[model samples]
Target: MSDFMEKLRHLIKGGEGCIDHMYLDTVAKVTVGVGNMLPNVAAAQALPFLLRDSGSSASPSEIAQDFESVTEQEPAKVASRYKQYTQLYLPEGAIDDLLDRRIEGFERRLRDDFPDYDGYPESVRLALMDMVFNLGNRGLITKFPSLTRAVRENDWAECAAQCRRRGIADSRNEEVRNLFLMALG
Candidate 1:
């Protein structure tokens, strides 16, 4: 991975803790492996989930059972608590792969929206990627028109002012703001 990707991976993992087991996110979505949401049973089944005890590959039925087990539990519990609902886990390497795939997919969407994405300074790129990671492509694009306009116009200070997200920690917001500010220097 490039240095930027390595740094981004660390940043995202820190923000979204890596959980091998499926759990309900704050919004009750079935999520695993650094905030990866499995929207349906088929999405969960498509991954290579392993038996937590034996580390053997899980059968489809076992995966489905585990998925259902997790879904039945109360929503918004701690991620570790959800482990009790299933005997399945995603291996660490698989988690990394999933994160990589998500980053690549988001990058594609970002490039589509910002044709100059690749040419931006490292700090600008990092801030934008982190924003895209937190807010989906459409969310960032549609919700934050001022921030997108600032970015397209290379107005780093404006970007910093407009990038704050709801429900995110203030520290994370500051970090993104600082990244944009860094681009100013």
Candidate 2:
């Protein structure tokens, strides 16, 4: 259900202009999933595009100052808050890790389907890997027919259109759109 949760978060976050976020020291940055270029980007800029239509009441500097002092809230208090929040609000992304093997399953399935296009470009690979990571082997297998056809013919527009047809809402569709756009560039 992790994929489902990811899609749900995408919906909740308004989807557009979405970027992964992380804190680096006292600064914030947009995560490229592997890199961070804008280290000093304000929290207001770095935070994920959640459903908050209102702007920040405090300035970015003020927000950073508050975060700096946040440790004083006490370990137990913080722990309690975490428990309460998790129980009432936050998503629990904990996994079993029971079913994770070498992923020979994916390789076998991909070969059987998209026999051509033995590999993908780095950007395209990132997009495909993300979709597979989120959705798993079975999920990828389900879309084998259309995705395989697109890759075999090297029709990226059709491939992206196929991507848009699958996944919850347009969750994976955005990835396809961005991936093909970058591939063209």
Candidate 3:
């Protein structure tokens, strides 16, 4: 991964640090390892390392069933019942591996779906990747035709403004816009 990609992950994963276990995020998703969202118990199959460290001899299908057994609840409620209800755990490097996979998927989507992505500035690419990391898809960028066009034209200012116009607050949007400007400078 590029330095910019690391920086993007740092910015977005802010204060969360490197998580080494699975838990319920604020919105009730079974978030595991780092920011990997486990949409279903079957999703756990992707992290064999974590499963091995979970200390359970349960097969993948059994683990998926366990994951499915947890009721969808808020973070606090999940935390309260965590010890009694969940058995997910991650050893060192498991979270990193999962994050790497997620990042690779996002990069692939960015390269294949975004026109001229290879030719865009590093900052612009990183910003889009950051957005993809958060949104879990490149479709959000496609929703803003002006932003994509501005990026393709290498119009940093317009791209920044378009980022803000997407209803993101100025403070948060400025950080991303400034990244684009930094590359232009």
Candidate 4:
């Protein structure tokens, strides 16, 4: 991995704790390792889910049953609490691969949106990648106009000022702000 990918992986893992079992996110989305959201049963089935008890691959029906059970539980409950709802787990190697794939997809979207993405400073790239990871491609682009403008202008201070996101922890926001500020030095 590149230095940026390494740092991004560390940051994401720290921010979104790695969970092997399927659980609901803060928004009630079916999520698994590294905050990977499974939008539906089909999406869940695509993953290499294994039976927690037998360590054998889960059948499609089994995966669906577990998914349904988890989704039926109280939404937004603590991630640990949801573990009881599913008998399936994703191996650590599978989780790592999923995270890498997610990062690459987000990076591709970022590159498409920002023609000059590769030319941006490392700090700026990191900050933008972090934001994209949290807010997604459309959310980052359509939701934060000022931040987008600051990025296009290469205005690190303004980017820092405009990067704060609602619902995100203050420390995470601060880290992103600091990344943008790093570009000014």
Candidate 5:
């Protein structure tokens, strides 16, 4: 039995600082019909699980957890809440479009922040995006040279190494390594 708010906080930390079901449930109600369609305005929802091999850029369906997958959990509270607040109970895809928009926004923001950054393919984008999402903008600065070198050489292993860290609770971790590997592919 997960408290909605507690789970939502973990989601912000767990899913690369991305929105979760709770986020959507919270925001969806406030949005007018047209406003709901906007990604920034769209709500985040919490799934019961973290994704398997899922990293910073993971989608809701990608979440994997030990105790339960989101698939195992019902959105009874979520659906009812949506109806109560917004007078709408959304179909799944209703939020997917918003997810895509958020990803795009993340990439765009990075590009804008690092205007001098060299060009990169979508894979490079994924690696950096995932890491930044997991950590923060400061992560880019901390791993700047290593991340750049690994991407330039197309070295997934090296990219994983570059993402590595210790001392603080922060780490590149197995999940993040999988993301870099996927990016390499």
Candidate 6:
């Protein structure tokens, strides 16, 4: 992975760490591994079976095995698993591959979705990806229209201001906005 992607992955991992067994997220969905959401687990593999479902039982060994396998799997499969499950349990194992694929995919999508994307600074690109990773593309696109416009115009100050106006804590907003400025310079 590129240096930029590595940095983004570290930031994402800061927010979404690895968990081996199945657990419930804020909305009560089954979550396992690193941020993998359970309902969509099938998309990860040819035999994408849930170690534990919302209403199913899973032994400790079974859960351990599921988590271990994720770590043991190849990079592509690991990324595929994460995308399908939303959480990938083994950070030590497949994180690099997962980050590479996820970041590259996001960059490609950004370029495709925005005509002005190619001219944006690398930091802006990274910030945009971070937003999508945290808030989803729809949230970035819909929740922060001014931020989107500012990004399109390469108006880093306005982008930072828009980021600061978010409902998230000031510290986090400041951190992200600072990242934008760092990229701008």
**Cα lDDT of model 2 by residue, 68-93, tens digit:** 33323333231223222111111112
Mark the regions of model 4 whose C-alpha exceeds 4 Å error after superposition: none
lDDT of 6 by residue, 84-132 (tens): 4323233344435545666677677777667788677767776677777
Best by TM-score: 1
lDDT of 5 by residue, 72-173 (tens): 333333322332222112333434444445545655767765663336544445556655654456666665677666665767678777775443234435
| Window of ten residues with lowest summed lDDT in model 3 | 76-85
Clashes in model 1: which pairs? none
lDDT for each residue of candidate 4 in 1-185, tens digit (9 for 90 to 100): 78888888888887778999989888889999999999999999999999999999999999999899988887887789998888999999899899999999999999898889999999899899889988999999999999998888889999999999998889999999999999999
List TM-score per model, in order: 0.94, 0.38, 0.70, 0.92, 0.39, 0.66
Answer with 2 or 4, whichever has the higher lDDT: 4
Off by over 4 Å in 2: 1-118, 165-172
Q: How close is candidate 1 to the true structure, as a TM-score?
A: 0.94
Ranking by lDDT: 1, 4, 3, 6, 5, 2
Relative to the true structure, how large is the alpha-carbon lDDT of every model?
0.92, 0.40, 0.64, 0.91, 0.43, 0.59
Q: Write the per-residue lDDT of candidate 3 for residues 67-111, one digit (tens) a residue.
A: 665544447353335434455556656666677778788888777
Looking at candidate 5, the ten consecutive residues that score lowest on lDDT are 62-71
- By TM-score, rank the candidates, best first: 1, 4, 3, 6, 5, 2
- Candidate 1 lDDT (Cα, 0 to 1): 0.92
- Model 1 regions more than 4 Å off: none
Q: Write the per-residue lDDT of candidate 1 for residues 72-175, one digit (tens) a residue.
A: 99999899999989899999999999999999999999999999999988988888888899899999999999999999999999999999999998988899
* Cα shift from native, residue 97, model 2 (Å): 11
lDDT, candidate 2, at 99: 17
Winner on TM-score (4 vs 6):
4
